[model samples]
Target: MSSSDIFLGETIGTAILILLGGGVCAAVTLKASKARNAGWLAITFGWGFAVLTAVYTSAPLSGAHLNPAVTLALAIKDNGIEWSDVPTYFGGQLLGAMIGAALVWIAYYGQFHAHLTDKEIVGGPGAQATKVKAVEAQEKGAGPVLGIFSTGPEIRVAWQNVATEVIGTIVLVLAVLTQGLNAAGDGLGILGGLVTALVVVGIGLSLGGPTGYAINPARDLGPRIVHALLPLPNKGGSDWGYAWVPVIGPLLGAAIAAGIYNVAFV
Candidate 1:
C-alpha cells in the first residue's frame, strides 16, 4: 500500500472503531433515558463487532491495526515493517480515534442534554412537584415528571481505569494474534470470527469489571480526547496521568505473547 493509502486507512479505521465501540458506550451510559445502563455485555459485543467490521473494511488496505499497541506488536514481530512507518501508523490511529469519537459525540448530543436535565429533575422532585402544582392551580398545565438514567460506580480513578484498560487490551491482542496464527493455515475460515468474539467475551466476563476493559489504547485515548474536546455537558476528567498504562500494558502484553508464542511453538 502507498503511504497515502496506509495513512488514510489508519485514520478511517480508527474512526470507525471508536464510532462503533465508543458510540455503544455512550448509547448505553450517556443516553440513559433511551439506552439506560446497557451494561458490559453490550460493550463487549459492541467492541467485538466494531473490530470485526473495521478489520474487514480496512485489512485489505492497511492491515487495520487501529490500536497503537497492535501496530507496535506487529512491527516488533515482523521485521518487514519499516521504522518510519511507526510514526505514521501511530499518528493515523490517534487521529482516526479522535475523529470517530467526535462523530459519536455528535450522534449523542441530544441524549447527553436529556440525561443531565433528568438528573436535575430527579434531584428536587418535591420542589418540581410544587411548581407543577402551582402551574396546575393556575390552570396553565400539569408538568411532566422526567426520569433520568443512572449508573453505579460513578467515580473512576485514572490509575485504576488505565490498569483495567491495559490488562484488557493485552489479553485482547494476545488472543487475536495467537488464534489468528492458529487459524491461518488450518483453513479456519469464518471460525476466526468466533475465536475473536470468544476472546472479547472472556475478557469482558473476567476482566471488564474495572476500567471498562478498554484493552485498546486507540479505543480509550481517542474517545477520551474527544471527551476532553467536545462540548458535551458534564464531561468527566481526562485521567491523563494513567494514560500510559493502556499504552504500556498492551505493548508489554504483546511482547510477552510474542515471546511465549516464539518459545512455545517454535
Candidate 2:
C-alpha cells in the first residue's frame, strides 16, 4: 500500500476502533445512560466488536495495524512494514484515537456532566463527591476523570501496573504475530481479525482488572491527551505521572513478543 493509503486507512480504522471502544466506556461509566452499570462483560465484548469492525474495514487499505505497538512488532518480525512507514501508522493511530475520544465526549456530554456531579461517583459506590473533594484537598491531583478516556491501576503499584500492561500486551502482540493468518502487511484477513478480536475479549475478561488492559500505546495516550485537554466540569487531572507506564510497557511487551517470534516462531 502507498503511504497515503497506510496513513488514511489507519486513521479511519483507529478512529472507529476508539469511537466504539471509548463509547462503550462512556455508556457504562456515565450516569443516566442506558448502559450504565452494565458491567465489564459488556465492555470486553464491545471492545472485541470494535476491533473486529475496525480491522476488517481497514485491512484492505492500510492493513489495519491500529496500535503502534502492533506496527513496531510487525516491523521487528520482518512483516514487510518498513521502518520508514512506521511514522505514518503512528501518526494516523494517534490522530484517530484523539478524534474518537473527542467524539465519545460529545456523544455522552450530558451523561458526563451528570456523572461528574453526582453525589457518589468518583471513588466508587457509596463514596460522595465531597469525599473526592477531601482527597483532592490532601492530594495534588484532581479526582481522576481520565478513567473514562484512559486506563489506570486499581491498586496504584507502579511495578505491578507496568507488569500487567507488559504481560497483557505481550499476549496481544504475540497473538497478532502468530495467530492472524492474513498475508497483508501486518493485517488480518476477515477470519483472522475475528479471531484476534476474540483474543482481545479474552484478555479483557482475564487480564483487564489490574491496569484496564491497555495493550496499545496509542489507545491509552491519545485518549489521555484528549482527556487532559477537553474542558468539562470537574474533569480532574490527567495523571501525566502515570502515563508513561502504559506507553513504555506496551512497547516493551511488543519488543519481547517480536524477539520471541524471531527466536521461536521463525
Best by lDDT: 2
lDDT of 2 by residue, 1-266 (tens): 89999899999999999999999988887778999889999999999999999999898888889999899898898655789999999999999999989999999989888887776655556776657664663263434456778888777899999999889989998898888857664677777798889999999999999989989999999999998889887677777878898999999999999899889988
Backbone clashes under 3 angstroms, per model: 1, 0
- For each candidate in the order shown, give its overall lDDT on alpha carbons: 0.61, 0.86
lDDT of 2: 0.86
User: Which residue pairs show backbone clashes in model 1?
Assistant: 169-215
The sequence of per-residue lDDT tens digits that candidate 1 reaches over residues 1-266 is: 66777778889877887788777777766544366578778777887787777766665557666777766665665433565787888888888888887787678777776754664422356467745543442342111211011011123465565556656666766665666532222111244445765776788778866545556667666666666566645434454555565566666666665555456654
Q: State every prediction's TM-score relative to the real structure.
A: 0.76, 0.93
Off by over 4 Å in 1: 31-33, 78-80, 120-166, 181-194
- Off by more than 4 A, model 2: 122-144
